[model samples]
Target: MDLRVSLQALMGRSLTRAAVAASVAAGLALTGACGGGGAGGDDSLTVGLLLPGGGASRFGQFDRPLIERKLKELCPHCPAAFAATPDPAVQRQQLESMITRGVDVLIIAAVDPELLRPSVEAAHRAGIPVVAYDRLAQGPIAGYVTFDGAKVGRLQGEGLLKAMGAKARGGQIVMMNGATTDPNADWFKRGALSVLKGKVKIGKSYDTVGWRPENAFVNMKGAVAALGAGNIDGVLAANDSLAGAAVSALNATEVRPLPPITGQDADLAAVRRIVRGDQYMTVYKPYKPAADAAVEMAIALGRGKSVESIATGTVDNATTKDIPAVLLPSVSVTVGNIKDTLVKDGMYTIAQICPPQLRSACDKAGLT
Candidate 1:
């Protein structure tokens, strides 16, 4: 099969296929040779995949396996090593080690993109092309794969407003944003603000440090105290982890009439929360295409082939301009589409989400 045709078929949507195949026609020939321990041009490529910590669960549970499996399928002997941690410095060290080990390509989901710049630059200096995964790292990135961050935020904001109904205008809501270090977090905040700034009163807003649930819990508690439980009508949590924290704070404070909360990542627990009427909605980014693209890009880069064929568009990073990228679309998952979205996608089974204790909620939502 033509690499270009295979790349197009890897994704589900025709629009995505069209966007990705545009540049493939120009870069059809494979140029790299195979031999040796280094990226000094060889197919014996060692691909290093560095992911952000297991806080979100998706990185380890889905992205890692999917990328590894796809790499095996694409290149039989090409080895892929993986690592993850919450600390930025630790991740940077890991990247440096991968570079020292002479991996041909590096795919990184930066723990802190800004702090990780030096290591990424080191990889570039060592002639190893780095592919920024999920979050756009600040460096000379050759390729990137992620869903539209701003769009994800817009979905969350729009869902929150719809859930709030008429109370959205005068109602007060807390904004629980992700860590400032993450570029995507800012994108999400900007997108959410685009929709929410004029429509509702932002009673209290916080940039959750480290994207940590404990930090979010503390921030939510402070928001409730500063704004008063009654004044707050909703919460715009950047992701499911933060949403869970906000819900915990609300429940612990015994706040009357829990407000609608928005989340991203569509975590299993978050989906369950939606079924139990605790969370309003979550943005479901299909993991397959993103992971598959990363692997395909890695293999291609390892084989000394251009990734223009795989990347749908070009994105500018802090230090790089016109970096090839694959930006996937995100879907809004609410109780209404739990069956069609998560279940249909095989992300989770009804039995997994609807526990025996929550059988009644599941029945009401028709998840049985």
Candidate 2:
């Protein structure tokens, strides 16, 4: 059967609850059957899930599995093909490979959204619809799924400024942003700058490439060196990874009773650091809705159907026209409401965050 014809046939067959449950079971049962992501059953449609980094644990532990299961539910016979490459060029290569393998659709959370435009365009040329997942991809995309990045950045900046309190106007802040390649990184920086530009004196700024904690560490050291240890009152670290790096670098210097530091992702380590007063704030974008949205859109695209059913809005990429986009909101988490943002959302259990060492801190914060 030809690709489009086969996809049409699959779409014609409406999914039933029983069949979806069976498909979910089959997908979960046959884990390693697919190459890269998952590919096995003859009737199973393949979706290439391309994530940018291995450093962010959510992509693997949460996003990958959830997306796989949801797609399976949508198409009982289809299994997923998940591949996450750390290198952007390798990611482009993997995309081409998946297209060559006749995978029905492509879902990418690009390392470099703009840089991958050519690759995404290539996939569209092959008649494979591409969905920009998490990280916005700059090509003619069918769909996109991610939390509102600008809002996340604004929340981070506001949280930091609030923590700084009396010094909000006269304080000196160092800005350490995420990798330059990601559109999300730029949006994050833009949002933070909107709130921070008029509020504080930006002593120094650096864009941490690859979102690597090490790069953040190096950049942070430069900021402290340029601004002086005692003069810098706040630090805007884009995500939890960079925040941790910045904090570590800060401690190595004379800075003590750490200044307010902003972060996002609410990673386990970042939460712990927040408890310790090393980091003041972080943004929490719940992963479940995002995972579920990607799965739904991927299945529809795989079957050559409209993603309009699941999309919340439309977003335009540099090279792409209007693409269906789902923008989930992010919440700011502070020492005062860690339980509300993380615990209440079921993102983390108190047991996981409030270990024996953090038990007292959790109690003090009324986290228990």
Candidate 3:
């Protein structure tokens, strides 16, 4: 199938629970029967899952549950221990704690890859395989699963340029980027620059601290102060959180015409913002495939099997080279295609996105 079609299908409504359970039962049993160290006979196996906290809400709302459910379905007797915290130090401690508990395998979404390097290395030394999820943790990780970071940025950049229209030639845009500690942040910046550089004037740019909306708010306020709100024709916000902040700052200054803003994560609020014309676009990356890949990789590694079957490709990180990976695609969402994208994908229903106050806006956008 075409890549775009496949991505659309992946992002659409997930498989039913009954279907998933049936597949897991048959497939995993077959895997073990093939003598590839499948999940069978691993009654005492333990998997450690570490996430980067609930900042995005997707982690807790979708990824964690999907991963846990898949793990249980695939390996009926294997138990999983989960940990999530916003602080990098806390994440490191959690890694250490998991290590001390002697987990068979670990799936970690590091808050800061560099700071978590030592912990990952220690896990490697302890013979515990680590699967990097979302953000690639710098270490000898066995597998990695996430969406294409650069593609995500390119989508944002393209959306911003399109929204700017005739103003694109000399448009001034403020860039509200994610935390510098994230490797994906660097990739996103590079991809965005590939489209934005030379084409538009970057009035102000900031590396948002901690990926927090409040920090983005402060940074955006600083940008507006430095560039003058009128001078900024557009804003390139790395994610929904930053986009919301940029919009908030613009509102505070009471800019007559709100500049078009680009965002990612297709967050519920951001989608609502897009529908309301407060923001331009966002990138939607389905969580099911990513979480599902991580679970499969974790279980396979824990069973002393290779993840060659699950990994779609390989990626080289700062400390590791040619690591197995599965990089999913992302879709750009705009008001024009809200139904085709988010609603069709079942990411959100019309009712959820269109509250009573937004009813008119939803109808106007053909979302009703």
Candidate 4:
């Protein structure tokens, strides 16, 4: 039940046992007393991390660990508590749990941003500021950190068009998008449409809820049913997870020499898919920079200091005004730029991203 324990043990630790009777009493008093920002005394720090889904696997695999490590670096003696639940309702409950436990600052990737507003508001009322990570969480937040999602979609759209080649206009493509609950999903869809609307015949479109691969598969199957497998030319998948689902659906139907498919998040599997020529491109948002930016922002906010030095610009959530944000660039990763984007940025090493299974593909892609 020790809060100082590693995050892998959070589930095992009984939350009730960790907060001593005196600790709760003191926390309750602090809730009533201090509401203004600029941080409490630096004697101790508690940072609560709230991530959305487990489908992508990146949050737990990369983001969470990095955030925890960076926060530790900033405050070695401080406690970094983590809570990961896929359900939006569960996420709200987790945030409240963190707030009640007296977290100094919260970093959240809300599953359902709109629904989580009340929880975020409750945190603000308790003098705990929330930082929207990846997905924007509404309400009075301290800051935001994410990649340029619109640019990610734009790159996907452009890559899809390029891969469509001479069949461009005549080639019909289905679009499988991310959940509409997250504003980033909307931005991604909008950005892709900006380039794709007039150019290609959009066969069918469906938004995957919870960014679930099964949802993508079902929607893609529906698209294939409506448009006919042979008529479909390309597919624009919002992220690597959805793209993998799309690929699975296509393979199930025996759709081979697959039409160009575009995706975001240069996940290891996605990179391999590209090398194999099944997936055309993926948008590579440098994970290191994104993780570093989030860490820097969290540390700054934890210390009750201005994040202007780290913020590249600003972004708007529904309820929050111009929130300070660190927006990183996204690069289009095809076979041609695999080395330049993912490898050069140190998001993954050749061995990590390309395994023995993909050795020949890696060689062909010039990644070996």
Q: Per-residue lDDT for 161-274 in model 2, tens only?
A: 899998899799998888878778888888898898888999888888898889888888888888788988899999998889999999988687789999988898999999
lDDT of 1 by residue, 1-368 (tens): 00011122223221012332323222211122333355534447778888885434878778877777777777766777666777787677777766666778888999899899998988889888889999988889898888888788899889999999998887889999999888888889988999998899998889999999999999999998898888888999999999999999999998978899999988999999999999999999999889888888877877778988888777787678777788888999999999999999999999999999899999999997
* Highest TM-score model number: 1
How well does each candidate superpose onto the true structure, as a TM-score? 0.89, 0.87, 0.88, 0.87
Of the two candidates 3 and 4, the one with more favorable lDDT, higher being better, is 3
lDDT of 2: 0.76
- Which one wins by TM-score: 2 or 3? 3
Among all windows of ten consecutive residues in candidate 2, which has the lowest summed lDDT? 1-10
Clashes of each: 1, 10, 0, 0
Task: Give the Å shift of residue 156 in candidate 1.
Answer: 0.6
Instruction: Pull out the clashing pairs in model 3.
Output: none
> How much does candidate 4 score in TM-score?
0.87
Look at candidate 1 and tell me the lDDT of residue 206.
94
Backbone clash total, candidate 2: 10
**TM-score of candidate 1 against the unseen true structure:** 0.89
Off by over 4 Å in 3: 1-41
* Model 1 spans with C-alpha error above 4 angstroms: 1-43
